[model samples]
Target: MSGAARQSVSSALPRSVDVAKVAGVSQKTVSRVLNDEPYVSDEVRRRVLEAAEQLGYRLNSAARALASGRTRSIGVVTLGTALFGPASLLMGVERAVRDTGYALRVVNTMEGDTAGIAGAVESLLEQGVDGIVISEPIDEGEVPVRVDVPVLVIGAPAPFAAPHVVTAGVGAGVLASAATDHLLDLGHHTVHHLAGPQRWYAARDRLAGWRTALAARGRPQPPVVEGDWSAASGYSAGRDLAANPALTAVFAANDDMAIGLIRALTEAGRRVPDEVSVVGFDDVPVAAYITPPLTTVRQPFDAVAREGLEMLVHAIEHPLAQPSPAIDPPVELIVRASTSPPPGKPREPSGSTTSYQA
Candidate 1:
């Protein structure tokens, strides 16, 4: 075939019959050549090969997978709530699966309990998913080891007991540390932390990072104020933080809490970044538009999800591969308008002092 004619043929034909027509051979001969079925004569095989090359015909992966007894579908289980991190992670998984020409069956678990997660997995299995990716954190003692298919868990590293949990690496810790350091860099003597519930891996890692950053600077780790990953709890925590005139900078574990903290501080006549600085994690969509845009850390959700899915697919394909415990993606710091140095000094206690407002 002439170069120009071959290019035109390649652009126009994508099926075996089209290649057969171009090569002037039977479709059966083209199929034999494609499958390496040995019955074709040499001349016929050469014609089929030239035609296939010219036509740029490639075998369909779906047909191949079906014949191989492998379903090209993956199951993804995640929280139903539209929280920033989980929602973003799900999107990333969908994007990666689509890029690989695989289908995804998403199951949203309303809660993070073992029963709920297991049920979601079961539903996905009923749909014939080749592998599963669980987007919820594995509670301390709740890893599932008996599922028949390969599963990838996408939270903090579960204990050695859990078989194939892949976590977004030091990203969470890096985020927490970056927020703390930002506060410190702004001349805050110490950064107080408002942590999330201990049951969550993110909560624990963030607290550890905050403590480590503070300790490295020889600053005292303030008593932790725990919240339930809710804005209400953050608001209540903020009330107590507002009482101490010396409490200059605060690092809330998530952006919701940071939003509440800012509101509480404003109500108490404390000016953000003037009287005190505030730093938060997650860099949620609304973080930048709040009263004073929040200074926070951004998680690499796309990279994390892509890695988690790839790991699960690998595990599903090769059941005997040695298990790796965790995977962590990197994090970046985002500087906004809400964080700055502390005010002059601690104000003298007086009738103005208020106890926990909640």
Candidate 2:
């Protein structure tokens, strides 16, 4: 037969029958192969594949899902802000779902309200999602009262009371300690902190880490300035740091704040790295493009998202398995041009005593 004639015949045939006929097997065998059921021989699998290609047969995902009684869909709940970190995490979750041949159903909270979160969760459940991934970072006290399905909470530590929840393994303490250690290693006597909102777990844990590192090094803990994870708040905190000439190093909780601090320092005629060194967290996209390029801590958003989804799926498949929540992931410091030895100050001998300098 001519190629064009063959094409027309192939196009006219039904997918299931085409697969069966090409493989010289029954339609039941084709269905078994598609479903990955046990008892299918390797030779039969190869024949099925060749048949599928020859007949232009594509497995009907909907039909397959119906047979399995699963929608093969994952529900994602998030604050829905376009902030770099949250947005990147959402993309990562979507990527993981697609790669797993599952559909994604995203539900965004309205202004991070608890009611909004509860509603979003309900909606996902109503849609018959097989699992849920909560992308927002909430305090342990603020977690939803009850979720009927398996859930994975990203950003915050997993709630111990909730066995089904999994958190992004990255702990704020690790990020904070890494930043503090970097500044300390650069010969700064101590590192000051510009913190995020007190209610946030990240802010709390990071502050704790900073203090822990300072204590371990026997360095005095400086006063902390609180910001709301905004550039403006950072600018305000930066102004204070600029006035205190004794302040040599700083670690801002997030990159946005770091940018603001840098701007404030510049306006005050203090040269970054020369007069004051800065470190930040999140290592957002713009961190590298900033005037001096920020030294920062990098969060593994993609890995967190993938792990969270996988955990949720596992919980869905075996609701009684109840795995222990993982500890926060480790954070690494990325040293860059923004940090260096403090200017205009000579290092004192290790055991030397000096009069008050500030």
Candidate 3:
């Protein structure tokens, strides 16, 4: 048969036997290359890999798992919302998992109680996930869960004994403090906060940060406007904030709320950064293009995911003591048009022409 005919006639579902034949090596050698076992000579390893690639061979995950007693799959648990923070964090995590050569499985749960979270974990475990990552952990308001497999909890600390990886970049406390301090530094006498749900660790930490900033500077605390991390809730909170003439600065837990708050403030005839300065968190992509580009705190979701996945893999492999990994990524502040000194204070540049008031 012609070489082309031979290639075409080859089994589409290529196996280690086919790779061995093509590479002039034993099936054992091909298995070693697939498993990345040491002591395989470089030339032989290269030949085996080339043959595998040429034949479109894929290692059977189930067979490999059976042999090694590990599924070679990573699982993730997250809220079912399309919220930018969780969504972005998940993207980063998936990338990291793919890079680490593991199949990714995900389970989404409703944000009601710890039972939902527990259920998701159980589902992943049943599927035989070698490791698991919880992207957004709530207080869950239940007893801690015990996970036998290596686990990593993002955003909030792990409820049970496992490695907790804080998304590097911005912490709730850090962002809230920075946002409040920025407004105060710009001459806003006091700052009001539109807080996210108290059940969320992010929300509680942000609220604490705002309170800390205010108390440290001896500024009186205004009644907080509660929000569900939604634009609608922020709008509702903003209306309340707008009615109070004493309020000149506001810190929102996230950009979505900030956008809604800005809309409400504008409708109420309160000029943002002129009559009121607003700062938000997450620095969502559209934040810079909003009516008045939002001055916000940025979270490095991609970096956090990469770092987190690394930590998880390390835990899975080592299962013992090793050098500690950095838990949080450095937070960043993006100065934009939405923030400035309150009206009549020394006019600080907002760096953008989009007027929050206009």
Candidate 1 has what TM-score? 0.71
Please provide, for model 3 over 193-308, each residue's C-alpha lDDT reduced to its tens digit, 9 standing for 90 to 100. Answer: 99999988788888999999999999999888889999999999988889998888899999999999999999999998788889999888899899889999876678667877
Q: List the residue pairs that clash in candidate 1.
A: 168-328, 169-327, 169-328, 169-329
Q: Which residue pairs come into collision in candidate 3?
A: 168-328, 168-329, 169-329, 169-330, 169-331, 273-276
The lDDT of each candidate is: 0.70, 0.73, 0.77
Clashing pairs in 2: 169-328, 169-329, 170-329
lDDT of 1 by residue, 146-261 (tens): 34455665655432232343433425666787778877876788889999888777788889889988989999898999997778888899899999978888999989988998
Q: How should the candidates be ordered by TM-score, best one leading? A: 3, 2, 1
List residue ranges in candidate 2 displaced over 4 A.
Answer: 1-68, 143-145, 157-163, 320-330, 344-358
Q: Which stretches of candidate 1 lie over 4 Å from their true place?
A: 1-67, 138-140, 143-145, 158-167, 318-329, 344-358
lDDT (Cα, 0-100) at 258 in candidate 2: 96
Q: Best candidate per lDDT, number?
A: 3
Most accurate candidate by TM-score: 3
- CA RMSD per model (angstroms): 15.8, 16.6, 15.1
